[model samples]
Target: MTAPNRPNAPRWLPLGAAPTTQRRVFCFPHAGASAAVYAPWRGIAGDRLAICPVQPPGRAERFREKAFTSVDALVDELVADIGDQFTGDYAFFGHSMGALVAFEVTRKLRAIGAQPPKHLFVSGRAAPQLPDTRKQLRALPTPQLIAELKVLGGMPDAVINEPELLELFVPLFRADLTVNEAYAHRAEDPLPIPLTAFGGHGDPRADDDELKAWGELTADRFALHTYPGGHFYLEKKAGELIDIFAAELAG
Candidate 1:
């Protein structure tokens, strides 16, 4: 079952009614996405891990809220708002732009001496230190932006064809891209936590070497797993990926 709509806690969407569970897995979505993308994970994760999907502003229930344009500001607010959720065992799973946000939040939490995640699962994003090679899509015209999304292959064809949908989607999409593109990684000491990096073998945005570079950010165990697909590989490989997550968390 889906979690109740949390009007107060704007940052989290708890997957079930349980107050807590063995572990909490905070899942962050990619650019132009919302917590709904992770709703399926509620069943996939089972009871061992509570899937808490984050809902950033300017989308879904928070549609009226202004989206964050600065990554640093975003992380600062998230760390502060999350409060006691980090008290027990937890992990972070982020895809694409979300991975960078998760990484920054992890760093901010550690800096404040809060409890750190047992593991960090970063997917579809290169290590933060690597310079972004993708063309800046945030500044593209409406037609070009729509074309780029079509090439990315995650949005429904209906959404692409519907002009009314594009009216709302385009701005949010550009806002999210702007937030990600504006990010500037600040050097810091390597984290002591283990990190598991996931990448698509054919994804140009996150090459093998770039994914492997995640190792340098972790002082403990580091692993990289490549799946067979392009940028949105998780859509097709969710079951396999969730199995790996379950095994790792269980271990």
Candidate 2:
């Protein structure tokens, strides 16, 4: 693996001529979100790194396709889609349901003996191994499920108010929640990579201590950062998060 900070040219070269690490960060979105959610990040990231959002089926351009409900199956399909493309230094950032998907995808990459992420950044989720005690709300009636999502935040009031919008949003959310609620965690040795976990101060799902549980999954380095917001804190903390990514990927 290429160290992010390892100079690509001789040290004697002029500083401007020295090549810096330019990594590709694959991002996964929260439940019921499309790859479009990360579109704004390109401008934020600038040229320091590339932001590639993983778009699973059943959303956006893939709206006609069925979404994957099984976490393991989703990981398998994503890895297959990735193939051998991770030959270059890369990283991962995921939030909420996406956080879990990103972590599982990283593990699947390791299983295939493929290139691993230089660093793993996960947000809005607790450690995967933790038993999910949250009530099963995926199968709830549409009104109840949307209500629950409202309590969790992230869904705009406009989306909730429009019956036409709910027709499109509801099924995708059910599939995503099913993915989260049906997941079964299997024990594996900790990964040999740094992991930085992010959380919202007011997020009932993943508090400071819950976020810290991610440390147990990495033997290299572990960090936990909390922001002041609810479950959708990243919507407000994007700048700070990208800034950290820039600094971390530099080395």
Candidate 3:
């Protein structure tokens, strides 16, 4: 399949992926997360697939740059900045806020006549079109935000305990929450690629029916998998998830 003409992968994109893999999965982290979140997948994914973690600005190596507060702007930049990587056989895996970002990015890619992902794996989030019924926490003050994060099991105690790190992390994550909480879902035809939704049984964000709703946005195929933990369940189930990735992307 022909993709849009763009420069080769930029320096900001890491090259630590499996060299011999036949397919690539660009993994997007949840809100306030960095590319480091997916680092362990490199080893678990083995050689069948390459794990490419997406690093948004204001996180990790790109911490100096400002992060986008609008989903449209982020999607637009992602398509233009990293659209080159989608040229080959590739798919997208995103969790929580990342799931929403990845879904929108795929739509943008298609709108530009770029080669679409082979499959889309969404985790820890509801389908984009669904109305969020949860209380708004994006505008919470520092202490309250920390409380919400702890309640949602978003950050580790180690990171939360470090005052210096919390100072840096809070605003970046709040910006991402702004992107998430303010997202306006425009109606569009379902994408013609297989979609798989995963969630923790105890996840407060998206439950079974909400997770199942991801099928509505995909005309090709749909699947759902429920794990035993909360929003951050994948942290403990990475090895199992990697096995599933191998099975699904064998083509």
Candidate 4:
């Protein structure tokens, strides 16, 4: 295989390097999350798979950039930005809104005849075909939005309580939610890639049935795993989750 072109990388931050290994795992974070969210995975992934976390706009170091408000636009920009990084064997792992972004990015890569990931791990999200039944929260007022975030338990209490911090977070959250809510699934033949669907058993946002529906999105193998927590289950199960990813990607 031809080597991927080496250029100034964009939108990707390498957590650690496993130079001996040929495969990489690109992780996309949930809504309002930054690349730091995957810091723990750096150790658990061992020395065989590099953990590269995606840094979306308007978060962390990219706070000066505008966050994407549409999935299509985000995918297009990511594909162009990443360029030749797809030449080698790689996998994608995404959680919540990140799952949708990863899925769509995979599709876009395939659409353009670019290389596809060896595996796709989607967590804390319903299958794309399933209609999102959750009430639209993107348009909710500031206090109401903060309340929803509190219920989701993704944001830290310190961040939630700080008005100055919330001023930065609320817009980023709104932009991400807009992207999530505005996404419209387009019908196509199932992807040939293997898929693993993961969720929280008690996640009100995504249930077992919705996760199982991911099987229909892939033409190859499909598996589902649920942990004992709510929507942000991976936060508590990161080690176990990394074990599963290491095993599957090693295969």
Candidate 5:
């Protein structure tokens, strides 16, 4: 596979997946995460659903491109870029900050009168209208920002131990932080698609209560699922996560 040319340009790396069935599930990464995070889901997601992981810039092969600093701009590009993947039935699954981005993308699709998703799976995030617990990290000093990343989970010890590696992540993390901090959720009509909210049972940022509130964002079916672990619980329970997603999309 060819490496990505830029940080902001999406790495449309397919997981060697062939959607043998009807529904296809598109996956989005969390803050500072790349499409490769969902690579583990490819085999188990079943042939019925194509688990295409959306790669945001500034990580993985996209290391050279400038990461998106604004949420609106990122969504705009993604909505336009994902046009080719809209075939057959489709759904969206996003984790942490990606959840909000997926929701916003859904809104943009709706506004443009595009085909809506069959289902929306939002994991590790609060409802759009909920209060933001964490403050913006872009304004923090570099050291402080790294500390915040530690608290968020998912950073490897090797990266922290190596100054060169950590330096590579600083800009990407900052851009992701800026995207999250600057996002403003304007009130809009509820979506017609069903929503399945997933979260870590022990995630400090969002609990079952906060996740359940995501039900209010949609007019269709709503369900909240909890897995064992912290903010990055999906990594620990990847098999179970794929199982849940497959079942939802199959239905």
Candidate 6:
């Protein structure tokens, strides 16, 4: 697996493709995060699930580029880059902001008559149709945005306090917030594939009720699982989460 930080290369980094295997899993990271977030899951997933982490700009190797301010633009770039890799049976797992990206991408792929993922694992996000009261975070002052980040428990305290790091990350945060806030769910037909939503039991962002709303978007099958933690539940329960993922793939 390539480290999240490389000298000067593309931001997205994928890991663990068996030379002979046909299946692959595309993984997307949360807002203000890099592809390295899924590095630890590579060993747990083994060869059955070849993990490909999608890295957005303004982070990791794409740090110098301007971050995408719209979800549509980002997904377009993603499809252009990874469209050919959609030949085999594939699945998608996305967390927080990534979950939003995955859902939008699925819709885009379906519109173009491309192969959709076999399964989609959405973590730490509420269905787009649900009410999102935190939309104002996009307009919050710098200090307030940093404070909100601290409460989300994803960014390290040191990074949040560092002026240089904050300057680098704040724009990305705003871009994510814009993507989330500007998202509008048109009254379209439901997806034809199974949808799985996972979230922390105590996650204020996405509660059980909100997560279950994903069922309305998929006609095939829907499952919602809750773990014990705040926003970043996967951090504490990665082992059990991997087992759940393995079982899902096996089934």
Which candidate achieves the best TM-score against the true structure?
4
lDDT for each candidate structure: 0.82, 0.82, 0.84, 0.85, 0.79, 0.79
**Model 6 lDDT, residue 104, Cα:** 87
Q: Rank the candidates by lDDT, best first.
A: 4, 3, 1, 2, 5, 6
Tens digits of per-residue lDDT for model 2, 69-113: 999998887666554445566788999899999899889889889
Better of 5 and 6 by lDDT: 5
> Which has the better TM-score: candidate 5, or candidate 6?
6
**Model 3: C-alpha RMSD to truth?**
2.5
Give the clash count for each candidate.
0, 0, 0, 0, 4, 0
The list of candidate 6 runs beyond 4 A from truth reads 1-11, 14-20
1-251 per-residue lDDT for model 1 (tens digits): 22333444554553432344466778889998999999998788787567878888888887888888888888787766664566566788999989988888889889998888888999988898989888989999999888887777788777788899888888888888887888888899999999999988788678899999999999999999898888899998887777777777778
Selected candidate, larger lDDT, 2 vs 4: 4
> What is candidate 3's TM-score against the reference?
0.93
User: Whose lDDT is greatest here?
Assistant: 4
Task: Kindly indicate the candidate among 2 and 3 with the higher TM-score.
Answer: 3
Each prediction's TM-score versus the true structure: 0.93, 0.90, 0.93, 0.94, 0.90, 0.90
Model 6 reaches what TM-score against the true structure?
0.90
- Estimate the overall C-alpha local distance difference test score of candidate 2: 0.82
Residues 1-251 of candidate 6: C-alpha lDDT, one tens digit per residue:
22223332234554433221345567888888888888888777776666677787778777888888788998888777656555456778899889999998898899999988888889998998787776468889998888877878989788876899888888888888788778877767999988899899888788888899988999898988888887899997877766666667667
TM-score-superior candidate, 2 or 6: 6
